[model samples]
Target: MDRPLRLIYCVFGLVTFCQASIIPCKDDDTKCLVSTANDIYPKIMSGDASIGAEILDPVWIDEIDGSVTILKYKFERCTVAGYKKCNITSLRIDAHNSKLKLNLMCPEVNLSGFYDINGRLIILPVQGNGNFSIDAYSYNINIDATYKIVKTDDRKEYITIKNFNFDANAEKGAKFQFDNLFNGRKDLADSVLKFANENSKEVLQEFQRPILSITYKIFIKNIYKFLKAMPMDNIFKQIYPKLHSFTCVRASLTPPTPCKADDTNCMMTIGKSVYKQVLTGDKSIGAERLEPMKFDEIDGGLTMLKFKMTDTTISGYEKCDMKDLKHDNAKMSFAMKITCPHLEVVGTYDMDGRLIVLPVQGKGKFSIIMDSYDLSLTVTYKIVKDDGGKEHLSIKTYQAEAEPIKGVKYEFQNLFNGKQDLANSVHKFANENWKEVTLQFQGPIIAATFKKLIKNTNKFLKAMPMDKVFL
Candidate 1:
């Protein structure tokens, strides 16, 4: 749906919520713009989805001289979904005819966005009946009306009605649909992957940077201009960027337990709001020593990261949910064991800084060092999807020596061992299978999409937080 951006313009301040938003109604009831409650009772019992009803009209007594003028009366269901994942893919060997079940849920889901501070923001994850209530795919949506423009006189305050949750069942449903159709044919891999894209979209964990950086850069660049014009700090105040959901938690290859079904080494899960501390560094400094995930997958969760090439290697397991983005960000224990001293992490990453974000879009930028100087990589994210699904972040690094003052040439041991390095293999594959590696996004689209993805990450970053996100 191509919709224009319309906003409820006003100053930001504490506004009391009115009673018009608290009335309960069926999912299919409608038609309450006017008329008495008894007059609308017949329509309410008729099971109509179009007839509107005013939920706030009962207690909403506003006389024109000594009354309330309600403006911008609106309603919507709010939802919230988690926005973090791992850099690995579940390498599950499905049993023949096995029915796979993934009833995952987003941190937030299906909720309201446009709302009134006066009305009640009733939220329902999914429309259902009772204790055994299951979501009725075919149901109606009802809302109370009183803050309409016809009643507006002076109040401009408003509340937001929104829902942003990751629907795990919906996501798993998509995967299952395809699993049922697959007959174990390699030729069908494309279709399966395509389906994954159509349903789950980008698999990378840092799909918010591009949007954040662009927006942040724009803000910094224009803040002086705005400050030159306006004086109030509130004028410059914007929605602060927040680190939402993170579910990339993967299991450890070797933890305190056997790591099987009974393993108790999983990450300790957080219930509600969690305050996690993280450290910040640059390409010059990296984790000199790192190990695999400290616990099991069931413990809590892993931070989903699609690192390009960092100078440092944090030990952890690679989750399977992050296998789609073309540029493999996997930190396989084997790979880390091999390229320990050769890589570099360059660029900027969110080490935890509060930022003002826009309502619809924002971005964040991050850079990391491998361990020593040399390996440098930048992770970026934005508020929109422009990059197809791949990143051109790979930079070829060759061990070079510094110039000697005299005739002596300093020599250092080559960290790389094999002539046929994985870097070379990856390059070869890209050159040959560029179509598959890059997919439909081409080069331009790739930049457009990811420019916003990685930026919105790291808001809730933790220090050396559970490294096992390799997929």
Candidate 2:
């Protein structure tokens, strides 16, 4: 009797363990289904992916009259949407009457059948095809689906659609069928085809129900295969790398320590080596300064940096045509030349105790020699990072003062024949044109040049693995 009692207790424990393991398997299946549905349904609705069917053999046959009717139907290029032009709100397991809208084209449905005469059913084999289209407002569908877990022959579990049903309706004008059967009376055949087409709603309703069921079954099988192929634990590890402890390095301090405790007061020095590496590596900005960079720590997590470039030649090419200046009445046609031989910048930026967001404002002075008369300019600009992790620079204000310099001249052989007054007039006109042209080109050129700068800086900061760089 004691042996029998022990056997029964062991059996109960085994049953409980099996049931507990099955619970998690069920939960995982549910999660996989929901994730796949959320990812795939939108693509099908947007026409990015298509669902369709094709049948080649004859579908219907009549034995009494010796008549054979072959019907071929397909739903081609269908785009699904929500009811009343709204977006699909939700999709869930065991959901019923989920409304959907489909815009589809039914192209060239072929039919072959026998026609009846006044007294007898003639064996006049008719073959014809017609195209039909469904408008967005006219076609509407309601769907019901439920899923179940099944064990395969290999004892592996899978999720599959157990039941699926749908009903659809379309406007009368959306129905079309062809009848090129009668020997001589084409109009009568057309009338018959139209009549058949009018009642086609019922046929379509029956055909679509099974197609949806098959589609959902395929979807469920694919999702299960995908989940089994790659586990979720590996995916999460790939996205989020291991976080390591990092600290700021200061030359004045005894040694570097972790910044996790007091990140707000930590100051990571941007030494000359880092500055030279970043500036020299970026070919787009083409910045080379002989003097060492000056960095000052300021209040409110801000840093001030002063950069100077002497005897530097900045050259850029722009395709200039007469048509670009559409609003200008002068219609002056000459090559546009832009250059800056010397430039200086003083900027202040706040990192907000984080490496992600960098906001910078600066004032710059540059000398521009456009074709001839030397012009000195001062401008204020701001560099901002957008939500999509792209950096852009915009000029807020600009001041340009042009003056004629001795021995500095421009030669437009055809327009100005070396006349001093005429040359001066052209230079004056060019200076005025510079204002508008500068406004148009400055934003794009600066943005492109600074893109490499911003990217390299962000990479360097993040590479430090420090929580905060105070200045």
The residue-by-residue lDDT of candidate 2 on 408-452, one tens digit each, is 221222223335565455445535555432322232223333333
Please list the residue runs of candidate 2 whose C-alpha ends up more than 4 Å from where it truly belongs after superposition. Answer: 1-40, 44-137, 149-163, 171-173, 177-185, 197-200, 206-471
lDDT of 1: 0.20
Determine the C-alpha RMSD for candidate 1 after optimal superposition of all C-alphas.
28.8
- Residue 219, model 2: lDDT of 39
Score candidate 2 by TM-score against the native.
0.27
Question: Each candidate's TM vs. the true structure?
Answer: 0.15, 0.27
Candidate 2: lDDT of 331? 15
lDDT of 1 by residue, 50-158 (tens): 1111111011111112111321122212111121111111111112322111111223222112222221112101111111101111111122111111112343322
